[model samples]
Target: MADGRVDFSTPKGGSGASRAVFAHFTLRLDPDRLTRLRSPLAEIFDELAEEGPSASDDVMDVTLFTMLYGLRAGTES
Candidate 1:
């Protein structure tokens, strides 16, 4: 099986807020499955933003998830 690694950061800011906040995360998963999940993940994230407190600008929303690093390997290193 092929493995893929994703390292990303999510920007955090509430509407009209000037301060910048960011959260970083790294995830390892099957590449093929990750590819298949792209669309669905996007939809789910969007839905969460739209249906949660973020919709009212009362909470910080992850406006962007920037991938900073990635690696793939046949075995864990």
Candidate 2:
């Protein structure tokens, strides 16, 4: 969000997530580092996507999971 806008017009393909998403913005964060970023990332998606009501931008409802933990790696899995 610091700069530039996301271009949802074109998409690429790969073996994993890159196959569907047109972009992959990395977060300099550990899965266990608690933050408010999770909400806006997965929550607002459905409101606009609407379960793929159209023939395009209709990807499956994949698990949009997020995690947060202490600064150091913990014993938790």
Candidate 3:
């Protein structure tokens, strides 16, 4: 999405013509995982803040929002 180059390998017969398709699949998978990771992290962050000392919320929110919103663009970006 950021106009960057990625290197990935696939099955020989399914390789060349599938570069764009496979890259799209792999990129989509990472965001799904990231969104999953962020959900629990946000919950833990909220609990920690409620209990005692905690990290900065603004930083965390911005990071998570950026990631989630960025994923909406998909590989076409």
Candidate 4:
């Protein structure tokens, strides 16, 4: 496990549901790889940040799944 923290915050009005939702996570990786991973991760999180309250649950699910799939695929290459 690499030693570091990555944080993500939603924009003031971007959260989808009326109820509260929270996500906190830690990723362990080589320090040298952190810089390479940050940009793509940020891009994924940025998409989530732009999702409006009107977005359907299915859409959100797919978006999240796609992010994970892409990351896995990238790492396998």
Candidate 5:
């Protein structure tokens, strides 16, 4: 590997199963909150999809999700 730890090309498992089976998950978001998030998510995807190849490299998904998560949490709380 480029990081000098392990080769990604190598097989890391046997049955190809993920160890993170719903661990440390958060509470379920109600249907109303989910409906509210849909439009914003679509807008984000649409904006990204229409961007040119030379677009800025500073865009971050975590920041966007964090903002949305905070807004949703505030409304529910």
Candidate 6:
């Protein structure tokens, strides 16, 4: 994504009696917002990690993960 190439999973709505979906997105955050976002997001992920093992098994695993990342080595500046 360093070269500005972002990725997302195609939204899916399964053929079922009720509506369901698995969606994903990538977004560009303004530089100034990064600091404000990191700590809260980390705490959320930590809480989820702690609660994960006790979650009931009737549903599949769902996750929300994010990171601060850099572009691939050969990408443009």
Question: Which one wins on lDDT?
Answer: 1
**Residues 3-76 of candidate 3: C-alpha lDDT, one tens digit per residue:** 54442345467746533332122344566687786798788778866876446662312112222333355575
Task: Summarize candidate 4's per-residue lDDT along 12-32 as a digit string, tens digits.
Answer: 476644333445565667655
lDDT per prediction? 0.57, 0.49, 0.50, 0.50, 0.51, 0.57
Stretches of candidate 1 off by over 4 Å are 1-22, 41-65, 68-70, 74-77
Per-prediction tally of clashes: 0, 5, 0, 0, 0, 0
Superposed Cα RMSD, model 4: 14.4
lDDT computed for candidate 1: 0.57
Pairs of residues at least 3 apart in sequence or in different chains that clash in candidate 2: 14-19, 31-67, 32-68, 32-69, 33-69
What TM-score would candidate 3 get against the native?
0.30
Better of 1 and 3 by TM-score: 3
> Candidate 2 regions off by >4 Å?
1-34, 48-51, 55-77
Query: Could you give candidate 1's per-residue lDDT for residues 1-77 as a string of tens digits?
Result: 03522223343553554454466777786777677757676787788768866446444434555553347567957
Residue 52 alpha-carbon offset, candidate 5, angstroms: 3.0
| Tens digit per residue, CA lDDT, model 2, 1-77 | 25534332334553334323433444567554435666566567766577555455654434344443335546966
Model 5 residue 56 distance off true place after TM-score fit, in angstroms: 6.4
Please, what are the lDDT tens digits per residue for candidate 5 over residues 1-77?
Answer: 37653323323555665422222435567778867877887887788668734446743232123333433445544
Candidate 6: tens digits of C-alpha lDDT, residues 1-77: 38743333333564433333344666577656766777787888889778766546644445455556433448668
For model 6, the stretches where C-alpha displacement exceeds 4 angstroms are 1-32, 55-57, 69-77
